[model samples]
Target: MKRFAFALWLSAISLNAYADSANCHQKANTPESIAATMDQALQLKQQLNSQPDPVVILVRQGQDMSSRHLTWSHAGYAMRQPNGDWRVYHNLNTCGTAESALYIQGLYEFLADDLVNQSIAVLRPRSDIATALQTLLHSAIKLNLFHSPRYNLIAWPFSGPYQNSNGWLLEVFARANDAQVWSRNDARRWLQLQGYQPSIVSAGTFERLGAKLFTPNVFTDDQPTELLRKGNVGLNSGDSVIRFIAHYSRAIPGCEHQNLGESVCVYLSPGAKRREKIKNRPSRREKIKNRPFYANRAACKSAYLRRQVVPCGPSSRIIPISVRRSRAASAAAQSFALRASRRC
Candidate 1:
């Protein structure tokens, strides 16, 4: 974004080629139609490249929207784009030039099904992603996102330290199902049935959310598991609070504030249980590790679907409850969590 936002300025210039608008909403067929499909893929790649919602830092800003293409592992060094067509060659060890990186909006889109069809058969990250989804879901089923299908991956876009790490499993499953987000906790359980007992603590934004909150005391780390306490937990331990906050940042999707790991930069709402959990863990009352239910890893988590399996369809096709609606909350109470983690 930061990079390609200005340099390319090419989308407007390139659109002139397709003069007449053909309403071929139907899937494209035929060689010429197929070629057009490739063109469409290029366009999609360009559009995505130009305006990515970057869930991860590695998917930097302003990389070439159309230039970065993956040929696939089944092939050679060349990798293919999420689209089946439009292959581009690049290096794995290096970041690409402006002409190479496509600005895929919301890095998570690059990990979706509409973007990744079953036919591509090139980059099969299903196992890895499915496993992570299930592992994360294992813990999320206990959270408030347990039944809402729409709130699966990016459940807590804005939250506090205690509520930060509950939704990573949703993203893991969404990536696996090719669905951008999950609609129920049952899907999580179903994935578990497939042997996807996801329980990793790898650190990344737990949700692929759109809202970003700025807070102190949170850090986004490279590990798979969330480390709530950089060192140890204590009531007066500012550093411990900061680490907990950082873990929260990773727990949230689309969160970019991880450097200011100090100060009360954000005001998030921790659910009653989370509030109680924090109180019972790092406060002056007792050491977090000594607690009866001490979460040794502090690998924050989220919720999953109900037993009802909803087929993957359009975002607007059907209606279901969401995090904002179904959480067991009182009118005066909020379900948000607070977190603060930065590279700082």
Candidate 2:
């Protein structure tokens, strides 16, 4: 009985050792901090609304990775639902453990993470690719095929027991781009074929030792020994994922809004510039189609109060009584609200 009890205690200790708290120091919830988070969410919503595509890769500056010269620390799929509401699908570590779970959250919730700044980067994939990704994201089993609960902050791209959030996203993207990529290995192969490169982060000996000893979700064993010895580690990161998408589909830079209220958008391809020059002004027909159809202000207020605020026009201006066009929502939209209730 004593031996059995000792074994149980040992097991408990092992579990606790591995389950190191993963929470990092977060910014205090001061008024400025709260405002910054709200501002970022608002700006992101406005920008996403301007895009024609329903899905785009949203990168966040959640952590101060400036020491590694990395700008964006996380990436997630921002998808617009049929009801015109936006949602972010991403993997989040579970309760400060090495385990993680997928989270489907709103723009406000996504930006509320302890962000280092209010800046964000958006990568708009090609129309076909975006459509393919949207379909995959809607799939039940397919979405989890590349997801591993064992979290690693700097997981190796090709193969590893653990996976990072960005790494999971890259695998899913590979599967979407190539139908043959049904497995993680196949996804990695496709990524290699497409010349997808992982971002290199420099970690010296002391830093490596410190991270290995203290951090729960950081691991270096998956990296090559030679590279580790040289203090260079290659891992999947937001920047690397964006670079791959840019090359694979020739996605133009959408927007990089910094914390200082400055917005910079650079279109690499000439076609993107021409398209940008052509303002997306709503046509007279579209304006008429989008005009509200409510009979009076009372009916419009009732519909709005019933959470029916959708299909608002590009102008999205507040006018008397006319509610947004009340079109029959598609099957996808009908099912979207149901999916929102499911555990991610």
Candidate 3:
């Protein structure tokens, strides 16, 4: 009996060790990777500090979906606080699980998440739109109105039962653009009226079936049956959302492209800037094609979680996405924790 008890203890320890190794959230934080992430974050901070608007839509390359022809994998709202600090508000899926929650994280925390590349994009809405978004970000009630705990990596842009991260951001943007957008349905309707087009992602039956069976975070039920039959899924993506915003607002001419009221810039790394650098600054469309996404934000006035002050310096190089209609592509792409603890 004693021998059997000792054996059971040993098995439990082995199981615990295996579980730690199997943690899906594990990241390879090499020194080079950590430095690159900090470089991106510091540059973003500078850009945000110079922004006149209180709120901007920030997109990042959280995962490498190049195989799927997608550049960005996540989008969030970065709002400047009264203290002059910037915080990112977005819904995040918990460790690739189907359940999700909203998170109000520091700029560093947002960028530090396991990233595919150090690319990010900034979409500065028109003055009025920015004002509306700023209010919405502060109001927990308004943000939660369209939020659903049920999450799917490929949630259909116009359906329910599941809402992907980008889908939530799109709906919230619609609400800010049009006051009549009170519910998720109303937001989708408003988006359609504004000519917002979701990118169609193509996946074969085997691929889709495999994802559904093994990955709890992916589902095709929210996708239209017609699309499913053709093996094409229409979903919200960073590129699609950016294009629609630029087109709907009317794209401006240069790097600092302006929609009817908003300003959009895609930040490129120094290395990329040299490789794809044009003789002269090109039109927004040309810049979009030539450069990657992302522009840095304001300085970090205070620190949260860990670390003292984040070193902020000059802004990173930025380019813009074109407003023209392009072939549809898809990329796979958080919530507030403070409020939940009180509830618990």
Candidate 4:
């Protein structure tokens, strides 16, 4: 009896150690979690298969700290595979690098965000649009041609030089909807004409300068003029993409406006009745007009230049000839620098 009790005590100790190790690696990509998520993905796949429409777009709030204010930050198209499982097609940046790649992954892999909180959004287009989007997806050449390796985090909605993940989806969406849009530039023009607004990140001049100097992934040329003029940069976040889709497509009944923390599943069949047509919301330009004058171009430019220029003072360094013209000029330069630093 004594020996048996000692054996049981040893077993308990072993089990406790195993539990501790598991807890330490809880956030790591473990096979058990992946398998569980796969099961969930299969369930979601079945639900999507029941929809009358064949294709739906998925949007999720990104896990990055920078994406906290945005409603959604990533998007991908989901479609049923030959085996009946659903797969997502989208572009992803190569681990914070300037390179990007087209990814065709399972729903589980698509939703594999470290900060995911058990919720996602689904956008189902009208039957005709769904068919068109699927048709475009079938063309490898068309998809590959636009798959740019240069990933710009701040890519403008209307730019062609570089593409962000959401920007790629936006371009693909444009091609799927319009046959005339054969190139990225054409797609961008279409989006601009439709008044599609990209999400704006409020970055001061010094922050922008620091990012440009230190990070290869931050590209500013693609930012929208209005946003850049206000010391902010435009980004193709998932929420903005969903809004753009909502502006153009009809949302299925019971599928529009999903509550937070609830996963959305939509089924669209050919015979399914179309929901109400989505109206175009106000443009970013219209919204910005209501903001304070400090967000305007002149103020932003002054603030930006001040941050870029070094301060003039004896404590910091010798004053430049331009700043040494007079005490008033030196004071003005110092004031400008201070304001710029404050903004930063």
| Global lDDT scores for all candidate models | 0.25, 0.65, 0.64, 0.61
Model 3 CA deviation exceeding 4 Å by range: 1-23, 28-36, 248-263, 269-344
**Please, what are the lDDT tens digits per residue for candidate 1 over residues 254-319?**
322224433112211123235545656665444422322212112111111221224332221111
Give each model a TM-score.
Answer: 0.18, 0.65, 0.68, 0.64
- Minimum summed lDDT over a 10-residue window in model 3 is located at 329-338
**Residues 208-313 of candidate 3: C-alpha lDDT, one tens digit per residue:** 7666655666778888888889977777777786776654332333554323224467665554456455635588787545443222321121111121233333
> Ten residues in a row with the worst lDDT in model 4?
13-22
Q: Which ten residues in a row have the lowest lDDT in candidate 2?
A: 12-21
Q: Residues 102-206, candidate 2: write the lDDT tens digits.
A: 878888877676554545567677788889999988986898998899987778898878887887888899888889889888888888888888989777666
- Give the alpha carbon lDDT tens digit for every residue of 65-90 in model 4: 33236655677888766777777888
Q: Assess candidate 3 and give its lDDT.
A: 0.64
Query: Arrange candidates by TM-score, highest first: which order?
Result: 3, 2, 4, 1
Q: Is candidate 1 or candidate 2 better by TM-score?
A: 2
Error of 1 at 216 (Å): 15
Clashes (N, CA, C under 3 Å) per candidate:
66, 1, 23, 6
Model 3 per-residue lDDT at 267? 62
Candidate 1 has its poorest 10 consecutive residues by lDDT at 12-21
Which candidate model has the greater TM-score, 1 or 4?
A: 4
lDDT of 1 at 101: 15
